[model samples]
Target: MTASNPASVVPSIHDRFAVVRERIRSTCVAAGRDLASVILTAVSKTQPDEALEAALATGQRVFGENRVQEAQAHWADRRAAFPDLELRLIGPLQTNKAVEAVQLFDVIETLDREKLAAALAAAMQKTGRRPRILVQVNTGAEPQKAGVLPDDADALIASARDGHGLTVEGLMCIPPADEAPEPHFKLLAEIAARNGLSVLSMGMSGDYEAAISCGATHVRVGSALFGERISPLKPS
Candidate 1:
């Protein structure tokens, strides 16, 4: 499809949201759970502003972005028009960018290491932002991934809570693409329960249903909502 084509040919944001919401509803129903308990975070990294406008018009208040720079550029101004919007940083964070991340996001879902934890704590002290945080656990133990290993998650969470004075609200994870995600989701849920944390930010578009069934409280959905991201949009 070409850009010149009428917008009618493109799936309306309402249509996409309805489809995804229905899927979430069905999944929750199947699990004997309340739908309101789940938070549907539209992953908006690399998505164009027009697409974001469409989603905002459809009342999508929660969104996830994969990069600090991109999110700062894309949302800095647009947020003025949607004061109630909530943005979550869902990507791996660098120690150097902790202050910016603390300022730019309402939640940070990729808290994975001590260095990063310390940086974020210092940043929070400097900025007084203190966005809610989640410890990303590398449940699959993939060397290339950016989460704390499963064995280390408990200690990291404790440090973030007791040492750094950061609010470790929950746990997040990205299971290996080739593996069944239920086990990982289940593990995250267990970890959260043991630590008295309430949020379980697991699941993507492909495995969200299973994640929900296994007790995911937040699902980061991108492609299913906005379609595959086009080439990066110039930050507006």
Candidate 2:
């Protein structure tokens, strides 16, 4: 399955899913984790509906997108396309877009600030639906990133849970590209546990296997499973 439009090209969904399944299985086995514990979400950032639909056709219920605009245009129309599929916002939640993000997405995997958390809370009040969210952490503590400071994670998590809206599930982090990931992933899991949180959303296409081994409940993967998503879709 190839498409001239970058979105249409899904080299081999099954083959790709199989490789991922095998990787997930092996990682679970190696980590002494139940293979069913980790759920694989095919990140469909730049891919077309067909690509996502194809994955959904294969019984894939989890799908992720990186931008509010992209998710809105690319997947908002998908309520009927993949009704049972779970849609997640795997990117930073813009403060202004919190309302729409809450309305459209099942999960916002990038909740990183008190303001946005508050905004999502307000949004949920209007929509009568609170979105499940994970606080994004700048685990590497990079100045150029979007997550809240790793040290401040607790304050935000507490706020989210106490808020009238927003289900504070757990933490999400993007480690520095140059780092080993094991330490960072392990750190995220440990932090979540310490806070008594349940979900630890981390890792992407490249090192998710390691992320899973370290107890990542949700792995957001794209390029590896979808074959190097081309631009105008940059890796988030």
Candidate 3:
């Protein structure tokens, strides 16, 4: 009946972060883009505090979280210690949590429907905090996914910008796991370009290099940076 140490089971967060950064650097170079152009947003969801501390020690400031409550638990207190931390809500956000999301997150990357947009608009006005917004596009049109379908993206973007007075800064997408990601990436980039949006948040640990080549301004990498997430319920 011995407890196991997570450190021994997973790769050092420092080493993993360095490897991801180096890959980003090499990918950017090969794509003929400045390394600074692509933001390495370490997807920190489900990672423990120790992992976060290690990531912060490496000067990794941007993080993406999938849940509001989890993000609050992970970073609410750490905000003072890491003032430069930029938190992006990379999951489906419920309308009821708009206020908290607006107050906590630096960027909300899953703006899909008009009701959520209206909620966020009111929340922003109430809290006096305007988080950057990215309309998530469900390029694969998956029913289970949270993003707006590709055909409906422009209307939503326009509504977020014009109807709600929110500054929709960019587009985010998660391509179907089974399909090739480049086409989805290209579609997202095209949507951004036509809308005059500059930021394209696509790619994950597996296909970030291809995403860089497709003009992704931000890549949300998790396992590559923090090692595979270990489930809390799993036996040690």
Give the lDDT of residue 49 in candidate 3: 74
Tens-place lDDT per residue, model 1, 144-174, is 9999998889999999999998999999999
lDDT of each: 0.90, 0.83, 0.92
Ranking by TM-score: 3, 1, 2
Residue 65 displacement (Å), model 2: 0.8
How would you order the candidates by lDDT, starting with the best?
3, 1, 2
RMSD of 2: 3.0
Kindly report which residue stretches of model 3 are placed more than 4 angstroms away from their true locations once superposed.
1-11, 234-236
lDDT of 2 at 23: 90
Winner of 2 and 3 under TM-score: 3
Deviation in Å, model 3, residue 208 alpha carbon: 0.6
Cα error, residue 49 of model 1, in Å, equals 1.0
Q: Candidate 1: which stretches are off by over 4 Å?
A: 1-11, 231-236
Worst 10 residues of 3 by lDDT: 1-10
Clashes of 1: 0
C-alpha-based local distance difference test score of model 1? 0.90
- In candidate 3, the residue pairs with backbone N, CA or C atoms under 3 Å apart (3 or more residues apart, or in different chains) clash, namely none
* Decoy 3 TM-score against native: 0.95
Where in model 2 is the C-alpha error above 4 Å? 5-11, 163-165, 233-236
